[model samples]
Target chain A: MDIQAYISSGILEAYLAGELNEQEMLEVDRVATEYNEVRIELDALRESLLKYAQVESKAPRQEVLDGALKSIQEIEKEKFFEVLDDEPEVRIQRVNIVPVWTIAATILLFLSLGFNYVFYSQFKNTKDQLAALQSDQTSLANRVSETNEQLQYAELRIAHFMSEDNIHIRMDGLDLAPESFANVFWNKKSNAVFISVDNLPEPPHGHQYQLWAIKPGVAPIDAGIFDHNQLVQELKIVRGNVEAFAVTLEKEGGSPIATVDKTFVKGFLKKS
Target chain B: MTPTIESKISHLLAERNKEAIELVFTHYGSLLLNIINRVLRDDEMSEDVLQSVLLKIWQNGHNFDSSKGSLFTWLVRVSKNAAIDKTRTKDYRLSQESKNGVEVVSIAESISTGDEIEKLYAKQLIAQLPGDQKVLINMSFFEGYSHKEICENLGIPLGTVKTRIRTAIKHLRSII
Candidate 1:
């Protein structure tokens, strides 16, 4: 083959462009490998292209190098994990290092140690789990007892409210709060008053709900003050001949007088 | 001196030495970036590809047989192939077409000459080439266009494309 004509055929350039079919590329590879002259010519052509590529060279931003190094290190770490995945195979290949009986003895020893460790771990885990279950049971029992006490108290309140000896009065919301409502349960014999505040806006900070027993042409007697957390509360028992019950917002601790304009709800007593 | 440095890099890379990263990046980073940028036509994407190219070279360093070609040749081949693969992806093609709709044509046209190319790669080596030869070299060598594709793209005969690329290579070798 005429080396000069072959070099001039542009096949080497086509090979470098990676445009040749696989067979043609193999042929070019074979020629370049067999002939020193073709190899030298191919290297020179590659050098020229490299120089051409150098013409457009622009330095990448400075930080890209750091980013690249970080990525490489991370990939290296992942590769290390992948190598670990193949560790058992590598260990198997090293079986010839020791005598067969010695190796078997070592394997048996390891198996015994492994079983001991697993049993100990499971025993300790079961102990811890049992302790946790006992603690949970104790807490749950306490909660159940607390709930039972609350249920008993609720039943007593229902019986008291349903008794014929109590006068039940429904209170309507005042002009200040049209949506507020409460029920007054007044026991006739004991003269005790229990008010169930069902729906009332939260009182202003540093304020409390005050109850009063009202009668005609006299100062409104303070019943009792209660926080909003409880729906039903007992108030100071009225003495006798109470006309109506009213609730007002007053500062913490009881006030001597009701803030009439701040009354949230009021109810009138009717003849039974 | 350059050959000695190249051999040092080749050895370090084969050994998987971290020091090879600095040496390779300092020596050929720009050239590789330029090759990728030529194919990608986006500076940001090109830079990203440049990093992966170095990583590829590092990971496959043992495969680089110096008997076949110089280290520079291998780097160029790897970088060019990576960039070409990126361009062939559906995401890249769709984004290129959707970005400006006409940017695809402009990118192809600007392979030979453009304002950005004028400012960035205005080395006197390629600047001094005759217009036709420069265009052929830009498309064939830098853009990785084969002779047949060059023919179809330029609307010239395939024989003409091959002859011009061969002539351009010869002229470039003589100049260097």
Candidate 2:
């Protein structure tokens, strides 16, 4: 093949596009290896295509490439473990001997001290252990006290969260369970809807509980979807005059339009 | 192992030479991204492609034959190929073009030259192409659209799209 002519023919473009058959690819690879001119032409062609592509190229967001680099680092770390496995037994033996000698020396020292060392070491060890235990207990108690304070603070926040003067909608569980109830803390000022599903039962796999705000005569708008994993699901329900809030069992990602048959809970907003 | 290219790469690998890897990244990362962005056009997808390209380089550095081409060329090819493959996917092309329309335009306008001569060269080459060719090249290279998509959008045939792009590329290669 006239490698220079072959490369200049724009077949490399087709090659880059994966349009070439196996034989053509092999032929191009062969010529590229054999002739420097072929390789140079091929490289030039690729570069030109790349340059053209670059003009159209958008700057990739930094975060995406950072994620890739992170994964690459992880892979490289894994490869390090593999390399460690390839060490010779002699090297392993040399590495093992130091720890063994240190252990033996410590045993010898303990043996030399005999009963005197035993009693003294036991007393010392016990005292140190007791000190550690006492410290651990004190720290644990402090942690418990701190956690209790945090718990109280969290409770205060929850109480405050529920108390804010906004539309409160109480959803009574439907045929699924009459006793079960949920609450919607609609903060119109913040345009935030917090769904408290504390009382509701877990939906079946492939199903999620969806909240909908229904106006007097209009179709219900999907507020958001909540799952058992979430104690409270925060949603943004855009301003729409609605008479009531309803909950329905929908597919995992929520439905665009609500289905009545899957209705599990309903509640009318309390008028201020 | 002797101090061949393979050995050097292996040593770098064994040492977990982040500096060397980072050097490669800082040097070629943007250029590679530029190539990918040319093909995919959507910033996120292009970024995804750029990552895959870098990962391939890291994993397969030993496979690189410097005797064949420079590392930059190899990276460009890999990035472009990955971007092209991603663009060729039905879901990627459809979702990207629709969801990322305005963002793509803004990104194109905001592309920083950052005082790099190569970047300037690339910018000049792109600028020098005829207006229609430039648009077609931009759509084809950056957005990762097939010639058919370009043709359909511009009301041109596939053959014209391919030839004009090929000619534009040839012109660029000559100038560069």
Candidate 3:
């Protein structure tokens, strides 16, 4: 978001007045931590409010301070309880209100307000439900990575792989490793390549399988290195154009150049 | 700016120093008294409430964590709670309810105005605020109302209430 827009959201002001609910307060805390200016602004608002409070401050009678100071030194109650001057003053005074009509009006107003509050809360609950649904709609797949949403993402990936914009390079194991196979989901437009291991034998702990993109006579591009235990791995960075993709066994870090002799599985685009 | 009183608060509490309580009372006594009076509006009661609040601060010294908030914020919150308790007392509430549903803020304001020191302090900062912003501050801070409550009472949308009050605070901050 625009920093200025976020700063102007008035969330900070609500935060200062303690008007924000728990969720909103957490948001304010997070925002204040991230933005230096927000913390500064929050501090300034607090200082200004404190000063205002001080302006309205009235000094208690001197006797009260004496009582307070006595309480401070001795927290033990029994000694002060019997002798000290602290007493619960019967300070309330009853005022006779002669206006019966206003009381009747107040009762009626309270009844109507009570009903209005119920309806307003119901409306608020419905709005909350709709907001929850909208959030689900936007990030439905992201919410569950280990369950139904993961299945959805898997389906989406498969559909994209099979789409017309994608080039599917099927790799079968070489003569030395004939049981292995893999597939590359190569999206040429975005230059993204995801590898799904079909039946490749796991390389030993100290070794790895590295994918390379070769343009025939040119030096092969290092697609990426993958952990032997991984079922699928997406190369971090991929550039446009490649004639063939190949996997080779290499030392753990992978080699700058392909280990040409160890091409366990290889595939080439049918130059169209 | 001088050092924040917050940095020294935890030390004072941890040491359980009597002199420290005196220092805190000298600096923040009026502020806490004002806050309680805003809620309770009785000098007689605010006196007792302020003592209890200060006693709580002394007793609960171990609970003060500076990371949670500044010392002033925490003190004001405790004062507000004590003031609430004062107002919630059966006698006080019954007496207050009988006052024709009108609050006694004017009486409290008059008392405040009589204190030249307090009046000057109040006017110095609060006078700098625009009329609208001053009212907003009064409702939000002194009356302890929420943003939504302010919106409902003022007949404006919540967004306008938030933005206007915030911008006012921003302008207030600049002058301070």
Would you list the C-alpha lDDT of every candidate in the order shown? Answer: 0.78, 0.66, 0.70
Residue-wise C-alpha lDDT for candidate 3, range A111-155, written one tens digit per residue: 999989998999999999999988887676565555677687778
Fnat, model by model in order, equals 0.49, 0.32, 0.52
Question: For residues A116-159, what per-residue lDDT tens digits would candidate 1 score against the true structure?
Answer: 99999999999999999988999998899889888887887788
Error of 2 at A230 (Å): 99
Query: Which candidate, 1 or 2, would have the higher TM-score against the true structure?
Result: 1
Q: Candidate 3 has what TM-score?
A: 0.43
RMSD of each: 35.4, 50.5, 43.8
Q: Chain A alone, TM-score for each of the models?
A: 0.51, 0.42, 0.44
lDDT of 1 at B76: 72
- On DockQ, the candidate that comes out on top is 3
DockQ of every candidate structure: 0.20, 0.13, 0.21
Whose lDDT is greatest here? 1
Worst lDDT run of 10 residues, candidate 1 chain B, spans B112-121
